[model samples]
Target: MPITLHDAFVPTAQQILRAVRGLVDKAERHCAENGVADSELIEARLADDMWPLPWHVRSCWVHSGYAINRFKTGVFTPDFTDIPDDWDAMRDQIDDALTQLDAITPDTLEELAPQTVGFELGGQRLMEMTGQNFLLSFTQPNLFFSCLHIL
Candidate 1:
């Protein structure tokens, strides 16, 4: 059978989102067991210049579920707002992403596959590609990167 755009994107995104959700749960448990405050874990970063745990968790949503929704608009832009600052909020963000992913029908993504999607950041056009390419090449990698940081 031929691989549809939906085949390539939605299931993978859903799986990654679920993994992120699990990681958030485990992190909460670890913090509680270790007597580490949620704030400390949320604010932790792998490096001095990198974003904290909450940002990485939020980015998973932004690059997966949020990116899929934005494809309908023919442009892709990274959202940096409303990043969760606590453990519960991080889990909530993941849950919201899962909910959004669940609402996406295969037909919607299939229809968008061949459509043009411009990627813009900081008011500059980074690149323009088909929706399929944007999702597979750009957003999926970004989702994985964010998830890796949380792990």
Candidate 2:
């Protein structure tokens, strides 16, 4: 089935969430590596700080679900914290968000406004939303790491 804006949003949200998961996983491994390497851990912290810093835990995906809804009411706000000290807590939420994303398809997406509508900040309205840009903002990582570290 052809993907729609809705489909794009959910998966893109999931993708962002997955990035968090990956970062958390990397952090965990780095911590477990017994100081053999600190670069990845340092990079993880830097990558995380790339987004608006969360004073507490709101900025993290564990609560923000990719920070798609900043106010938790679909509004843009300063949210998402850092990764949890115990990464295990993140599994279920990430899985659930991914599942929610899977439900998105062209059919549901068609109901959404065009790319120019702009993502909602709080009113659940698409006043200036544009699907294309929204999708990119959700999926694109401003602080992406290179393959060299993963290898």
lDDT of each: 0.89, 0.43
Candidate 1 lDDT over 1-151, as tens digits, reads 8988888888888898888888888889989999988778778899999999989988998998899889899999989899998778888989889888889888898989999999999999899999889999989999999989988
Tens-place lDDT per residue, model 2, 1-151, is 6655555455555565576667657666867877645343443433444522211222333323343333223334332334433446555445654665565555544543342433444546544434445444532332122111222
Give me the runs in candidate 2 sitting further than 4 Å from their true place: 1-3, 6-16, 35-44, 47-85, 115-127, 137-151
All predictions: root-mean-square deviation over Cα? 1.1, 6.5
Clashing pairs in 1: none
Candidate 2: worst-modelled 10 consecutive residues by lDDT: 142-151
Off by over 4 Å in 1: none
Model 1: lDDT equals 0.89
Q: How many residue pairs clash in each candidate?
A: 0, 18
